[model samples]
Target: MKHPNDHYYLITFQYLGFRYHGWQRQPHVKTVQGMVEKTVNYVLKDKPFKVLGAGRTDAMVSVNNSAFQLILREEVSIDKFFKALNENLPPDIKALEISKLSDSDSFNIIQDVAEKEYLYYFTYGEKMHPFCAPFMTYVREELDIEKMSEAATHFEGKHDFQRFCESSDSQDDFVRSITTCVLAENTELKANFFPKKSYVLRVVGKGFLRYQIRYMM
Candidate 1:
């Protein structure tokens, strides 16, 4: 059942995804949601608050284009929220955009979110950059770039996706649409420090199933 306080707001933010366990604040460990919620309370001067994310991101995953909504007692100032959010939030988590929700009074953020986007980075070679190891998962074995590209096209449109999704007791419908699917490979990004190399595989899509990218690579 949906909560009575279903009012929603669209929050845009970026995170390192390295230090925390994941986006959802689990009872056991550090997480992005835990940090964000703690910050919201801190900025509000020690008042408890709640929030809803489009979905949860698993451990060791980062997001540059993440969206969520917060339920707070005090009125939120967009500019002030943006500036102060980072103050209480950890260095890894940064708020980019905060759009006060506009919809029916009972709109549920989880159900109302239209879509989401995620990108995974691949780094090759021996010498690694400071951020590379933490930010990117390493792949040295030769993967069929052309084959990966072909596979990406297959993922376009709708699919059962049950195979791609991580098994969960909560997952009911495994059908998800891919609005935009693209695979890129180039040598434009040359390292000035270590591992002077080129990326052979890249992918961007509207939505992703759990460990879908990891499964793909």
Candidate 2:
């Protein structure tokens, strides 16, 4: 339950999750949420506040854009806070936008999310430069790109993805919808260190279970 005096703000940000242990905070491992909360606490000077992520990502999975909800006991200057947050946050994480939400607004980050897109960049047949290891995966054996592209089409549309996710006793619903799934040449992300021939597996959907994408790949 939220107090009547509480203020709500929507914060959009992006981060390189290569070093962090996914988005959620855990007991020992470093996480994006943990780092964000630490910076927020520093910025607010120990003021009472709550942070809720839109969703959780797996370890070493980077995000181009994502958001979270910040609930505070009192309102503060948005511009000042945003500036301070970016200044205090680590280089790998960036705060993009911040907007105050009115009391009449109804926004639940998790429930309200319409869709998400995930991209897996990979290359095969040759060893890649050490610098490329962080952003792309390399397989020693040559891969059949044509066959992989054909197989990707099968993942499209609605289906029971129970086998495509990590086993969980708490989850009862295994049905999920995939809006799009495609394997294509790596045109979206390019670098000099990247191999001449690389591919990307793109998946778009409303929701996904834990380790679902990894299982599918």
Candidate 3:
């Protein structure tokens, strides 16, 4: 059933975050939210709409899959609206799926999300191809894959990640648990620009403090 006052939509999309400043919109800054909202406004033909992201991603951080909650003032053809969004959004941003949201859900994506998975792709040793900059981090230093893999295990289980995250509120609980933490070969994502061999630091948890993944790498 639909709410009488509003229409809620959940849009799943992916983007290459290399050129964008970040997810949130800011005056005089290029941001993912800015681009998305601009395209949405154009597609709606100036009809009023609001967008809320499931979470925020730092600049240059690419996500394989992510979502945003869109609340439209008026009802629209889901198929038509989905296509219009894809047609207007930039090539770097792609919409994968769209679904109607129920009133009972409260249209709150952040609270609904139970866990998040992050993959930090990197390649060590020789310099990486310039084209790979957006998708992976290049490390010139020789990394001991064996040792790194072992050390990654230490991050498993519960611990205070206060040192790993960048937090303005120091009094907040920094303790968190890692359901999965591993340094593994990059087989999930492939590209012609990718190196012959690449690695990815995959982390999964209920939540993560700001910049924790970057600090881990």
**In terms of lDDT, which candidate is strongest?**
2
Model 3 residue 166 CA deviation in Å: 1.8
Question: What does candidate 3's lDDT look like per residue over 1-217, in tens digits?
Answer: 3346778899999998898887888899789999999999999989978899988887777777889989887989999999999998999999999999777366568888878998999999989899888888998888999999988889999999989988885468999889999999999889887899999999998778888989988
lDDT of 1 by residue, 1-217 (tens): 3355544457888898877788888998999888888788788788646788878887878887777788655566778877888777778888887777655365666676667766655655564667566655566676666666776777778777787768689878777777655555545544555355445334454456787656655
Q: How displaced is residue 75 in candidate 3, in Å?
A: 0.7
Evaluated at residue 175, the lDDT of candidate 2 is 91
In order, candidate lDDTs are 0.70, 0.92, 0.88
lDDT of 2 by residue, 1-217 (tens): 8788999999999999899999999989999999999999999999999999999999999999999999999899999999999999999999999999885257888999999999988899879888897788888987889999999999999999999998678889999999999999998788887889888999999888888988888
Rank by TM-score, descending? Answer: 2, 3, 1
Q: What shift in Å separates residue 38 of candidate 2 from its native position after superposition?
A: 0.4
The lowest-lDDT stretch of 10 consecutive residues in candidate 3 is: 101-110
- Higher TM-score: candidate 1 or 3? 3
